[model samples]
Target: MAQETAQQAPTTAHTAPARALLPLILPAALVGVVASLVFVGVSTAAEQLQHVLWGPLPDALGVGRYSVLWMFVMLVATGFAVGLVVWKVPGHAGPDPATLGLDARTMPPVVLPGLVLATGLMLAGGPSLGPENPIIAVNVALAVWLGRRFLPRTPGALWPVLAEAATIGALFGTPLAAALVVSEALAGRPMRGRLWDNVFAPLTAGAFGAMTTTLVFHPTFDLGLPTLGHPHWQDLVAALVIASASAVLGMCAVYAFPYIHKAFLGLRHPMLMLPAGGLVLGALAALGGHLTLFKGLSEVGVLARDPEGWSAGQFATMAVVKLAALLVAASCGFRGGRIFPSVFVGTALGLCAHALVPAVQPALGVATGVLGILLAITRQGWVSLFTAAVLVASPAVLALLCIASLPAWLLVTGRPQMQLRDDGTPIR
Candidate 1:
């Protein structure tokens, strides 16, 4: 009887950790799914609005769908509209996006709706931004609110981790993306238990989020390049050169980011700053054409599909225009993220490289370009590497990309990053 009781005690002890982890895993998984749904809903609404304004409305009015004049007018109108919301909204739309990044402070539940509305407007009308930061902020706020309401015993810090992981998973349509990003983020932090233990709840949340997003959206970023047979010596050299050049180019923007942000802040009023920003964006759009507008995710596809069709001059112009648009959108209090626009800029630059030198593989050129630009912009090596490799949709080139990333990292390390100041001001 003594031996049997001892065995039973050990069995119960073994089960205790799993039982305790249930609360963490379950709530995080729930947050992941809910966050994915929220993102899908928000993006869908923006798409519909975009179709109405840029598609049906123009057709109904007997104007060309790609009319540059109309595009300028619409963008200016979008800027004014978003500015008005920021001026009068209950939460001031939860902070300027140019001053925010993936690691922003969690906002209150009351502010979530305002942020969502501003993001939708920015996305739907026209802005060189993506849904990443605002949507992540929304999920973080929602997750925290839900946790307080239902899982009072849960750790507070875990909420942001799970929220970030879930949203990243949803955004990229893969749990691996979130895992890599989280691992990189949490690598140096002191923690108890195994590293995987820290990652368990967040990875679980990310898996659910990715799966849910895939089911609903079925998004793809494949450029449909012919299968890369093997990495050639020339490919390595070319990738290094391309990535290094792109990094150098990106640094120019990084240096300019703070100054532009400060200039916009000097205006000190949404009425003045946002609308003026809108007009600047309008002029850029008129100059760069339709492909240079928007948050730039879909534009990458458009560029990739027909790289050969465009001349080197055209590609260079697009790259420059997109970079400028990203700067304006970010500095002008736009509600969006930097990743997608940065990716677009990189793609344009890569296409230019390929056009100038046909010997370079499109996949290789694009991957390295993206790697360099993302590194320079975000200052995160793993995220930059992952984004570059994933954009190519070819795992075979990852080894070459790893090699290319070394030079790229060297260029971007210690450079000014695209994050805002802690006191709700521009980082100078």
Candidate 2:
């Protein structure tokens, strides 16, 4: 009876934790809302700055908005400015960005400003990187500092999870992606309760964060591709082939990453490395065209909107060029994320497939391409699958993506990932 009672105690206590977590819903929601607002705030500031630099200033100077010379000038100037921030700012903008990932680390609050500055400059300066890494770091740091000051009773570890989930939720404009990603991450850790129980607060935070971003920003991942109906057996084959091929391409970039970084390291300083990278990027821009610039989201839309405008050769060039640009930007002391640009590379590659084999559906090619490349680049399977499917927004495509991800995942698995440690070794 004693043994049975003791076992029963834990079962009952488990229920208590679940109930205790219910109260956390309020705090979770609050944190989610605030974190999302921070995302919005930072993104808005960057867009405004980008407009000033590329729009009015260029127009006032009588230079074409996307002319090669202007691109060279802006890219060089942005490199120098960001280099100054990294060199002069405390904490060196919180370590080499190549050493970071989607998982957030709490940093001293003072590092946030410099981090934001570098991130903003990179965003506006035509780097083939996204805002995910720094933005997540910023949100996590803020949540940790504020949570410790205001709610001392909360477990010290929860703040990072809450903030990370919230920021990811805000980033994708959907709680589903955040919940899926956080669940994958948490599943690997030792836990005291049911997986769902541990996830409760973080899920709430993701929900509120996604909701806040949706209400405020109205962002959409759906590319409005033509509705995909029932899939054929050939569709499965196409998905597999395209995804596998895209993963192989991403692996090429992964292989080249360390060498690229090593080359930049020879330049020996941020000032020299970034400016040199900017010049190379300008040359790539000339070849890849302006659409290969920036984070690749809107540019991808433009590509999709007018698929007939580009030939297969042009599509292939854009993919290779964008991939190279991403490698350069990430390798050369830039502060940003690679996911968005990788999506563009995948998009172009997928379209190239469609152009080469007219029987391959354009929409399916694009989705599978994104799935494959993201699988390699991020190694976050669920989020990669989600991002790919969301682009097409078809239940049919999701079915295909699930099958597509398998081969792609195998190809990327155990390969050298694109990221490197501070000491320059692969993190794997």
| Best-matching candidate per lDDT | 2
Best prediction by TM-score: 2
Please provide the root mean square deviation of candidate 2 (C-alpha atoms, Å).
2.5
The local distance difference test score of model 1 is 0.86
Q: In model 1, which runs have C-alpha deviations exceeding 4 angstroms?
A: 1-17, 422-428
Local distance difference test, per candidate? 0.86, 0.89
lDDT for each residue of candidate 1 in 1-428, tens digit (9 for 90 to 100): 99888888733212236666667778878989998999999999999999899998999889887788788788888988988889998998997776677875789888888889999999999889999999999999999888888888888888888999999999989888888888888877866656677778889989999999999999776777654558889998988998899888888888888788888889999988888898999889888889988989888998898879898899989988999999889888989988889999889888899899998888888888888888888887888888888888887789888998898888877666777674544343
Q: How would you encode candidate 2's per-residue C-alpha lDDT over 38-113 as one tens digit per residue?
A: 8898888888988899899999999999999999998888889988998898877887787788996689998999
TM, every model:
0.94, 0.95
For candidate 1, give the lDDT of residue 367. Answer: 85
